[model samples]
Target: MRSEALQNWLNQFTSRSEILKNIRDLEKNNEELFEELLREGLTYEEVKSRYTDFSYYKGLKIPEGARALRAVEVYVGIMDFSDPSVMRLPGWHDGNTPSANLIDTSALFGALSKRIERPFLANKTIYSRSNCLIRYTGEALYQLDWDVLHALICFCRGQFNKRFEVRQIDILKMIGLSKAGYNYDLLKDSIVRLRKTDIYIESSSKSPAMSFSIGEVKSLPKGKRRRIDTFSLILEATILDNNVLALTLDARLKFLFGNNEYGLIDWEKRNKLKNNDIAKKIQCLISGQKTNMQRHRMEKLYQLMGLTSSFKEFTRLLKHACEVLLAAGVIKAYAIPAAPRGAGQDRIITIWTTEIPTPEELQAVGRVAAYACGE
Candidate 1:
């Protein structure tokens, strides 16, 4: 198949004369007879001189970082920090996507529920914390599940309607997929979680209960090859189209992205670092928060980031993240506050705006969390 890059090259020289000339000059000496080349008047030249002739080049030929893929354009944008502002999407749930698998006990949300072992809370199945009530239902989604959701959210943001078309290659690229390559089974299970896991939100107002996804999948085997003569001529092989993957976003999600309640992430940077679990989770937690200034206990934070590690171990991972976040100024500094009485007893992490935080500000609520929590 012709890469999007190569197909673009073919489009540059629309004239047959230019195509034939480029082909012969670069064809590496094996120019055999063909009705097409004969029709175009080309010869089998075994040797060529390193001669230079000035030719007026056409417009930009998709240089290496043509980072202008359609989804990329929608999800990412260049920022002008002089007047700092972020892209906001309305009705974005901004849920605390705590990791299920990170803590061994957390995944118990599904298995424990199956055994009905609880003195059930709110709605016989609800879990509550300060000011929030969650009527949990179905198997809890893990970090991997959140991965799929985040990808879809990235796709759905700025889109008007709920429906969108995707190519398999596109999803792979967006997720910053590793060379280990696509895991078809994992993808199938993720779709099921999005479809089957149901939860009802009852914070500010009442709304409909919905399940994200439920295991149903239809395979779209690769489609028939596109018939582009110029493309075929370049590779001397057939080229196939990417398979289309169609999905519907939950209407609730429309509140997140469609309405402009989205967070701006430096995708270039995030994409580069996402393979590291600590790095990936921290970036999202920092950006996903609705408020500009957030202070959370290290323990709460560990839960929020979905880390199952002990205080000592999780902080080790978190310390690594602080290096990146601090250098980028995403976080001001960690403060293990000697708060009034018993407020925020655990180590506290105070986050700052995109701008660098002042030293005095860092010192005020400030005691190093590492020392407080035992580095």
Candidate 2:
């Protein structure tokens, strides 16, 4: 039975019939606490405040430094759970597929690279560029791992703090891999690596330093029986039964992805780049930058890609990658200028015009044109 105070609080949403109905249904399952609180002579607002406090602190061990951060208040009253579309994560929801893949700039820059020869390192700094620093304490991730991570991010974009379900096959398809038995095994390995990996990201320009695993995954048993052959993926914080892979993306990811600190990778273009790992890496770096024309030192590029090849071999590969990018329309032109006598480093200059430019980019172009015309 609903308490009078609970009833009064719910009455305020009379105009939103669907939300009101959902709220009523949810309250039916959660009425005991409200009833007990009402019996204790607590007012409606007091009860609500207490409930909010309880929900915020429930199963969470917030550190002293993190306590100063503001909490994201999610109002359950406005949520329309009856519509499955409403519950879908952003970018991949409702069959409205996004043309580009969204990724945090820090990760896009070079957090994960093609260094897979060494075993997992403990408390090792994987990548550091400019003001951003990334430390990892698990299996060393590579380009494929980056793709897997990006797919997970797409799955949990809007609901970063919430647990959700995803199928293993869906993940495979998202990363442009075939759904084969070997692929399933590979996916499981990647998932385990991601789960065990503890990442510490610090970007002075974005947010305070934070540490968390990329995600958590648990493989469910087959049906009522404990068989383990076929399984789907489920994203949940808690353990559950069934032949599925349960995943929970770390909530701390919001710090990196929020405040427009993320960039969009052209999904089609990336897929087209395919097995050319160097070109793909270059695409990621170029996509994350604001300007279409950019120059990067050859040594810096080599380090950023984590290539183990000799400088001469890397330079040869880079030239080939630039040619590939030009052929794919990812870049209009690229030039590797000859190093001057006594110069320590060579530079690669690239110019491009994206198929779809942001408003800010458009304005910048407009300003450039006006300046060129002496307006």
Candidate 3:
């Protein structure tokens, strides 16, 4: 009988503060029952069992600051918030100096490749290199999608499963897009596409297959309705309002960064090469390698770039891209060896040791190395 009454009272309140206030009121009338309920119903074990993780805390009256900390705890499993490495990362901030952009090795291998004319819902194998196979479903993604995703990741500071807010104009500026009306529309489309795109990765290594999306957008509720006659006004107001976009990255992304399986691309150089998709893709591919010198077959490069041009044209484009990279100091030198007699494939070899690191880059590398060593 008492349990039934307690559940009825609990269901009447939606927020935590309301529940606490009612509980205090109950204590005033029934001290013995209140103490018993506090011990049995609100114990630490019961609370922990009910709210096992951050996701379970949503829609509750938890403070946003506390939510952020709890999100880190749930995803990272680090109890000590005092650790500097848990809150900060190299190349994650935007400043005067160039910072590194974090990208998963699987993505850097051309998962988000050239643009497709039509969006497809069925699973399609977009990129396959060596033992890595990447399949994607949903809207077609291109260089712009890649740029938007990178900027969003920077905004989140590499924290997955945490909500962050940003203005559309700020996103545009971060991606080197001008603040025009059409650009805002383009940004909105890109965000939607990112939310819809699903990626599945398969590798020949011992690790199992992984699947995830880039991020999800949060929708704001409409304002209260005034009257039927004022419907148009309300609609117009909603359309004209400049609302901040809220986004949460997937927690599974942390798996990609684990075991030093991620790569850091020079952010400034990427922005410079933004107009040239081929050059940016090549830059990512080269940056993902462990050694300074790398070689790839021309046939494989053609497929990896998702280019529809003829082999001859692709080789021409590849040469030009290398020249652009050389001018930008992204690569030391590149050579495309001609196919020998009756050879099935030619190779494009590149060396990137000539590029000098900025002070920020060195500091970032030092921090990563220290963290890896568990310092």
Q: After superposition, how far is residue 29 of candidate 3 from its true place, in Å?
A: 47
Query: Once model 1 is optimally superposed onto the true structure by TM-score, how far is the C-alpha of residue 314 displaced, in angstroms?
Result: 2.2
How far does residue 77 in candidate 2 sit from its true spot (Å)?
A: 17
After superposition, the stretches of candidate 2 with alpha carbons farther than 4 Å from their true spots are: 1-118, 206-243, 341-344, 355-375
How many Å off is the CA of 154 in candidate 2?
2.0
Best by lDDT: 3
| N/CA/C clash count, model 3 | 0
Q: What's the lDDT for residue 219 in model 2? A: 53
lDDT of each: 0.40, 0.50, 0.51
Q: Model 3, 103: alpha-carbon shift in Å?
A: 7.4
The order of the candidates by lDDT, greatest first, is: 3, 2, 1
Q: In terms of lDDT, which candidate is stronger, 1 or 2?
A: 2
Ranking of models by TM-score: 3, 2, 1
lDDT of 1 by residue, 58-127 (tens): 6534321121121112111221112111222333433322221112212212211122323322222233
Sum up the clashes in candidate 2. 6
**Lowest-sum lDDT 10-residue window in model 3:** 228-237
Model 3 misplacement above 4 A: 1-121, 129-133, 207-240, 341-344, 353-375
